[model samples]
Target: MSDSKHSGKHDREMLLEMMHSTTKTSAEDLLISYKGILYPSVLCCLETFQALETFEAREDDILVVTYPKSGTNWLVQILYEMVSIVHNKEPLLDTTMIEFGSPEILARFKDRPSPRIISTHLQFKNIPKSMFEKKVKILLVLRNPKDTAISFYNFHNSLPPLPSYNSWNLFFKDFISGKVCYGPYFEFVAAWDNHFNDKTMMAITFEEMKVDFPTALKKISEFCQLPLNEEQIDLVARCTSFNSMKEQSENTHGKLGDSFFRKGEIGDWKNCFTEDQSKVVDEMFEKYLAGTKLGKMLNYAKYCKW
Candidate 1:
C-alpha cells in the first residue's frame, strides 16, 4: 500500500484502540482525533470521515451546517416543513445527519430522493468537498458562543453517549479550550466565515430566527429557491416554535426525548455563565471572532452582552 494509505489505516486502528481503552470519564476520553479534529466517538468514525472526502453531493441538496447547539434541528424542522408545504405533502423530518453515522449508514443516503436535507455539526473544512464542487446550497447557522456553550453543557450531560460534566465550570473550560467534540466554537465560526460570501452559502444567526421567525423563514426560502406563501410560513413558524417543538419532542426525537430541544432561549446563558466565565467568553470572542462578518452577523453586543 502507498504510504498515505498505510498512515490512514494506522490512524484508524489507533483511534479505535483509544476509543475502546477509555472509560469516557471526560470529554477527552469520549472523543476521537480524526485529521486533527475531535469528534464524538459515538457519532463519528474513521470510515465515515474518509468516505466524506469522495461523498457525492446532489446539486439540489440543502446542507444545514452548524456547531452543536446552534439551532440545527430547529432549522431542519423549518426546512422540512417549507419543502413539504411547497410539495403540498405532509412534512417528514429527515435526520440523515452526515457526520453522526457509520459509513454504511451514510451510504444509505446515496439513493435518497432529490432535494435531500443533510445536516452536520462538522466544521466547514471537514464537510464533503463534493458539496462545494457540486455547488450544493448550504445554510450555515451561528449562535452566540455563550448560549452555545450553555446549551452544549446541558446537551452533554443529558446525552448518555457523551461524557457528562459535574458542573458548567468544567464544561466551560473544555468548551473554551476547544477540547470538546468538533473542537473550538470560535474556530468553527471563523472557518465558515471564510466562505460566507460563497455563492452556495447563506449564514444566519440563532438569535435572528428566535426574534423574527417569519423574516428568517423568508430569507431561508429565498436562499433555497423554495417559495413559501405567507400562510405556509406562518404554519412553519407556529410548528417550529421552541415550545411547540419541545411539546412534540418525544414524538420527534423518540428516546432522545426533550433533551434535544432544551430551552432554545436566546440569553439563557445568563442563568449559567458566571461573571468571570462571561468575561472569558467575551475575551475569546475578541481574540478570535471580533470584527469578522460572522461576529457582526451574530450581533454579539446585542445578544451576548449584558
Candidate 2:
C-alpha cells in the first residue's frame, strides 16, 4: 500500500510538471522578469507553497473544495440551505456563524460545531492533513474547463486591482501552463481525485448540479446524512439556482462575489472563443486532460464540465 501510494505521488508530481509548462507568470514572478516569457520557478514556488505544514481536522467537519470560478459559491449556498432545512434554522445571510473570514475559515478545525461546512479554493496540498487522515467529508465541485477558464478570466478582470488580459490567446496559454492561481483545473481535480469515497468524500460535477438541482441536493443530502422530506428537497433545489442566488446577491449588494453565478448560461464559451480559438483550446484540453479519471465523470459539454 505504501509503495503504491508513493508511486502515485511520483506520477502525480510528473503530471503537474507537464501542466506547469503551460502556466503563466504569477504576480510575484513578474517582478523578476517583466518580459512576457514564463519561468518554471513559478511552478516550483506553488508546489512548495501549497505543501501545508501544521494541520488538523474534526471528524464532523464538512469541506467544499473547488478550483476558482467553479461552483464554490453555489455549493456554499447549498450547504447553508441544507443546514437551515435540516435544523429548522433561519436564513444564513445576516450571520457570521455560518460564514466567516478566510483566516477564520482555515481554523475551522479549532472551534466549530458539529457537521461543519467550510468552503475553500486552496489546492489539494494546502488542505489540512488531519481531515483526509481522519476521513472528513469533502465535496469537490467541478465545472467545464473552457467555461471555468472564461469565468476565471472574467473574475480576475473584474477584481479591483485588475491585471492581464493580453488576449484570450495569451490567457489561454498561461491558463494551460498552470500559471494562474487555482489552476490548471485538471491537475487540481486529478491530484485530489483519489481521495474520494462515499464515506470520506464525494466528487460531483457542476453539470450534474446544473441539470437537476433536486438530484444534486439529494446527493448532498445523503452525504450530510440528513434525510430530507419532499418539501425540504424541493426547497434546497430552488435555493441553489442561478436566479435565486442572483436575487440573494443583489439583496446582499453583490457581497457574496462571483461565487453566486458568474454567468449561468451554458456554452457561454462559444461567445468568447472563435472557431480557431476554440480549436486551440480543444487541443489544449485534450493534451492536458486526456487519460485521467477526472475525464470519465467530466464531459466538456456533458452540462458545464469544469
Candidate 3:
C-alpha cells in the first residue's frame, strides 16, 4: 500500500479502537492518546488531540481558560463583543473551546484572522507553551467548587461515553474524589492560579461576574487592553447577560444541548446538594485547599453552607 494510504488505515484503526473502547462500562476504559497526553475518552478523538498540538498561536491571541462548567461560554461571548468592537470586524469570530475536540473549531481557527479569542478546559500545564512564551493573554474563570460540581454533574449526565451517574450520591462521591474527566478540580484551579502573577494571565470568579456584570466587563476589557468606553461596556454586559445568552444559545450556536445553558445562576448547588453532600464537598475543599494561598484567597468556608 502507498504510504499515504497506510497512514489513513492506521488512523482509522486508532479511531475505531478509541470509539469502541470509550463505550465500555467503566470510566477507566475511556482514555485515548493525543500529543502524549491522556485525555478522557469522550467527545474528543485522536484527530482532536493532533489539532490541539498542531494549532499555531498568534501574538495577540486571547485564551479563555476555565474548569468545565465554570462560565466559559458566558465569558467568551462578552470577550467576543470586546474583540469585535476593537477590530470593527464583521461576521464575528468563533470562540469555541480548543479542547472540545470539535473539527469545526480547528478549521475556523486555522484560517481565522489574527487576535483570535479561543477557549479551553485544558489544565494550565497542557496549554501550548508558545502561548506562554509569546505572553498571550489568558483569562482564567473559576467558580466555587459546589456550584461547579453540580453543573458538571448535569453536564456529564447529558454526554454519552462519559459515565452518567444515575444517583446524585454516586456523582457527588466521584466529583469529590476527582474521578471525572479532565482530572481533579483543586489541581486544575491551583495549576492556573500559580500563574496569577504572570503578566499575561487574569483570573476571575463566576460569583463575582454574576454579582457585578459591568465591573466584570470593564476588568476583562482592560485586562485584554481593549479599552471599551462606558457605553460599549454597558452594551456588552447587556448582550451577554445570562438570560440573553441562554435565550440565544440555540439560534446563535445551533443545538448546544439542554444542559449547556442550564441554570447559569450562582448558588444553583443549593437545589442539588443535600446537607450530607454539601458537608462532603466542604470537607474536600478544606482538605485539598488547606494552607494553600488559593484557599486563603477564596475562603471557601464562607460559602460552605447550602
In terms of lDDT, the best-performing candidate is 1
Model 3, residue pairs in steric clash: none
Q: Kindly indicate the candidate among 1 and 2 with the higher TM-score.
A: 1
Off by over 4 Å in 3: 1-42, 91-93, 102-108, 290-293, 296-299
User: For model 2, what is the error of residue 232's alpha carbon versus the real structure, in angstroms, after optimal superposition?
Assistant: 0.3
Regions more than 4 Å wrong, model 2: 1-52, 91-105, 161-166, 251-260, 301-306
TM-score of 3: 0.82
Best by TM-score: 1
Which regions in candidate 1 have their CA more than 4 angstroms from the true location? 1-29
Candidate 1's C-alpha lDDT? 0.82
Positional deviation of 84 in candidate 1, in angstroms?
0.9
**Count of residue pairs whose backbone atoms collide, per candidate:** 0, 10, 0
Q: Assess candidate 3 and give its lDDT.
A: 0.72
What are the per-residue Cα lDDT tens digits for candidate 3 across 192-220?
66666557888788877888888988889
For model 2, residues 184-228, the per-residue Cα lDDT tens digits are 666677677654565677788877778777888888889877689
Q: What is the lDDT of residue 172 in candidate 1?
A: 92
lDDT measured at residue 117 in model 1 versus the true structure, 0 to 100: 87
Candidate 1 per-residue lDDT, tens place, 1-306, comes to: 112332433332323333334455655656789978887776677888898888999999999999989998899988888888887777756455687656765675787776788889888888898998899999999999999999999988877557889988998999999988889999999898877756889999899998987999999999998998888788989988889989987766655656688788889999988899989999999988899988899999998887
